[model samples]
Target: MTQHSDVVVIGGGQSGLAAGYHLRRLGIEHVILDAQAAPGGAWQHTWDSLQLFSPAAYSSLPGRFMPAQEGEVYPDAAHVVSYLADYEKRYELPVQRGAWVSAVHRDGPYLRVETSSGDWRARAVVSATGTWTRPFLPAVPGRRDFTGRQLHTVQYRSPAEFTGQRVIVVGGGNSGAQIAADLTGTAELTWVTQRLPRYLADDIDGRALFDAATARRRALDVGRTDTGGVASLGDIVAVPPVRAARDAGLLCAKPMFTRLTATGVEWADGARAEADVVIWCTGFRPALAPFAALRLRGARGHIATDGTRAVDEPRLHLLGYGDWTGPASATLIGIGRPARDAARQIRDLLG
Candidate 1:
């Protein structure tokens, strides 16, 4: 027998939890389903030492504030997971953990979510799976033949694991840079990326980024008729990890690899660099394959939602999508409005 709900939220991360909380506040009956056995989603799987670039004040969910000191750099992965668990319990959000959603289809008027455990039907669906579902590891030729161990940054937990190993950290993103810096003291480290990464200043924290993006979005909202997508202004030229690496004389900006060999990685310029380990911090793809019929607009498999609301399917909403304007869109702080808006929209539809 298929269980039923007025609305079913897929993915029990910050977005899903916020959605459930708002729905409950509006007297809507809903259930949140998450594939993970616990609540924090990808955060739980993050490296143990990982910390948010933003501060704790900007990391709170809708109802509850993050239990941390003001102006403190955001908590690590473990603290984030603990906070999510606390949020779930405090709000009494109806979350079914370890329920991996296999597929989502529109069955007549309701949305059918088929999971490993069972199936559920709902009047509406919110895809809060976030953008980091699948790690993107480039398949360079001879990668399989690499003599040293190769791992994606997703599986990487600490530099201690790669101690005394000559490690090549690919991709110049924040994660890659940080991992390289962390390994510098313990191992021989080299940083690589296709383009010189444009680093945003440390002052460009999550709140500031959200605020600037929000103002630009509101201008467009008022019929200003700006050409092209909202251009990200402000100083995004100082990647923290890159700056740290430069300060430590450990930064190396280079083009991506042409192939991987048993001995080492070969650059597109036909130069070969040897290493005992390769850490690919390429990036992540969205978890939208299950909802393939939605026809999203973003490159790299991200669902292109319009300011918290999904574009193609207005009834189907997405929260916590990366790169949204406002202090509350991508961060835990920004998720509240989107979740509340989605809840209101669902309540109206159900009524």
Candidate 2:
């Protein structure tokens, strides 16, 4: 026997919570299934001392504001998790934690969602599983042969654990740069990155970027019907991380490695860099394995969805997808519009 709902949200993060809240406001009954034991998916696993580059005002969900201490730069990961938990409790959202969705398939007219616990049937499904569930690490040649400890930024909690060690941090994104800076005084650090360097402006924060990105996303969403192939680099630029890294002289504006030896990494230019610990600051990708049937576009394994609708499957939708050259399409602010639009579409379909 399987439980049923008008809709089933396949994540318990902020996007999913917003979906549930909207659906409830519309009087549409729905259940949210999450893999984690609680809300706040990646935030719970992030490194300590991590704060949102964006401010509390822009980071808040639909109805509630993210509480913050006066003069705080941004809310930390723990604050984010606490805010999410409070949001869940306040709404009493129908979320079943620890129910890791293994597969989702279209069974007749409804979608069948199989989890570790059991199966569920829903008329509509919203994949709010943001693009950070899986860490994207390159397959370095001699990665397996390295005897010392190596871990992704996801597993890194703090620099306290790596005191006095030679650490090589790879990737040029915010995480990579910030982590490199964090380990600077505590440990010897080297920063590495691939080609096509993306730099942030000297003057933006989460609030400003969020507002700018939101406007751009809205314009694009309205102007274009088929946004499948269009790629937008949202407002990923903010001053905090970039400034911090620049001040610390930790930015590695170079291409990636060609090979990895047992002792060190070989760059494309034939230069070799060695370190005791290799921290792949490579970013994350969406965990879309459960929706295997829905073929995604791009070799990078990202789903191709129109602003709100999945390109391959009309009935399915993707929220928090990174849009090309716009405001923060993949951030928390970027997800709300898509989620709301998708939920509305689902409600109409159910009717």
Candidate 3:
């Protein structure tokens, strides 16, 4: 039997939960579909030492603020998991765990969501599935031929596992810097980047980044001069650990290698370094496979959207992916506005 809902939220992560909170407040009936068997979403799958770029007060869902982790200026992954779990229980949100959605297609006036457990027909569908599942690795030559173990951020747990082994960390972004910093003293570490790593000011964090993004968006909305945002500052934030690593001269990064070798990697200048492992902190793509039948993706490989609503199909709202969905929507603090707006639009549509 096909289940039914007024709205179907794919992904019960921070974005989806925020959407649910607003929808419930507006008296809109909806269900959140989570691929994970438990709460915390992607946070649960992150490295053991992963910490939010912001403090606890700065990272929170819609109705509830994340509690501060005692003795920690920046909370760890476990604290976040506990907070998300508690938030879910506090609101009693209608989330169906382990409901991995396989596909979503049009079925008359409703969007048919086919999942591992069952199917649901909803008047509107919200795609909040963030990008952790689709870790991207650049097409560097000889990658497959390399004998060293290669793993993306998703597979990494801790540096202890590779202690004393020659390891290379790739990419210039936060993940790359953080992970490379985490590997200090634990591995024979070599950090490589396509370009020199850019670090944000030590005082700036996700809070400042979110505020900048909001300012930029607001400025653009009023047709004023465009203001720069997080990108304007730099890529990586000088979080405590990252800053410490840099001060200690452990976070130095080399230019990207020309190709992977059977034994390790080689640079264009013929410099070679043997390695036992390579960690790709390259980032991710949107997990939009469920919407493949919609044919909404543009030539840029992203779905064109008019303020969260898909331009090709207004019935579908894409959230939490990135700025394309909403400014800073991928972050916990930034998701609320878009989630509230998406919920309101959904309510108006249902009416």
Candidate 4:
């Protein structure tokens, strides 16, 4: 039987749960479809050593704050997963796990949501599918010929398996830096970035970046086009682990390689760096596969939204797709505000 909901959220991660919290507060009837068999969303699949950039208080969803794990200041991935599960239970949010969404399309007065297990015809659809599933791998010269193990940050786990091997980490982002640190004692590691890596001061953490981004967005909201030298997410934060790595002279990043060789990599001047493993810490594109049939994407392959609502398709709201959808919706702290706005818009639409 085809299920029906007033609204459908197409992910059960932090974004979806935040949206669910707001929807529940409004007494809106909705359902969340998750591809994962259990709760936690993409965090469940992240590398085991991953830790939030800030304390537990900073990494929270709407309505409920993420509790710090016992004796731990900053929560890890497992702690986050546990919190998500508890959040669902606390609110009794209707979530259908293992229901991987295949596609979504127009269906007369409502939108039809197709999934692996069943279908849902919803009055509104909030796409909270984040970028974790679709890891972006940049094209390096002679990429196909490299015979060694090459993996993206998405597939990264503990660095213990890489012990005694030569590993090269790519990208200058926080993920790249953290992973580089984790592989420090285990692997003979080399960090590579397109440009010189920018490390923020030790006091500047994820919250600072969020604040800077928020300020920039606020400035953009008004007529002012100038963003008075705000920091970007691409810059690395000086977390304890990263700082330790730097102290040990391990955080140095080399320039991007000129090309890949069968055994390793070659620099522009013909210098070679032999590596047994290559971990690409490049970023990600939004997971918008289900919205393909909607034809709502802008020139950038993302759904153009006006404060979370799709510009072309009003019934479709995209959440947790970074600043393009809403200010800071992609981060745990940033997601709550936009989720409330998106929920309000969806509730008003349903009414």
Task: Please tell me which predicted candidate would have the highest TM-score against the true structure.
Answer: 3
What is the full ranking by TM-score, best candidate first?
3, 4, 2, 1
Identify the runs in model 1 with alpha carbons over 4 angstroms from their true place. 69-72, 139-142, 220-245, 293-307, 324-328
Q: Give the alpha carbon lDDT tens digit for every residue of 1-351 in model 2.
A: 798987888889877888888888888989999989877877898888777877787787777887874667677888889889999999999999999898888888888889988999888888878767688878878788777778888889899988988888887667877787678778877777764545555555666556655665666668954432212332235446556766666655556777777877777678987778989988788778889964555566766666567676666766665663124546766566666777788888888
Stronger candidate by TM-score (2 vs 3): 3
**Relative to the true structure, how large is the alpha-carbon lDDT of every model?**
0.76, 0.75, 0.92, 0.88
TM-score against truth, every candidate: 0.87, 0.88, 0.98, 0.97
lDDT of 2: 0.75
Give the top-scoring candidate (lDDT).
Answer: 3
Clashing pairs in 1: 199-236, 199-237, 199-238, 199-239, 200-236, 200-238, 328-333, 328-334, 328-335, 329-334
> Which wins on TM-score, candidate 3 or candidate 4?
3
How does candidate 2 fare on TM-score? Answer: 0.88
Candidate 1 or 3, higher TM-score? 3
- Of candidate 2, the 10-residue stretch with the lowest lDDT total is 227-236
Candidate 2: segments with Cα more than 4 A from true spot: 195-199, 215-245, 248-255, 268-270, 294-299, 324-329
Q: Candidate 3, overall lDDT?
A: 0.92
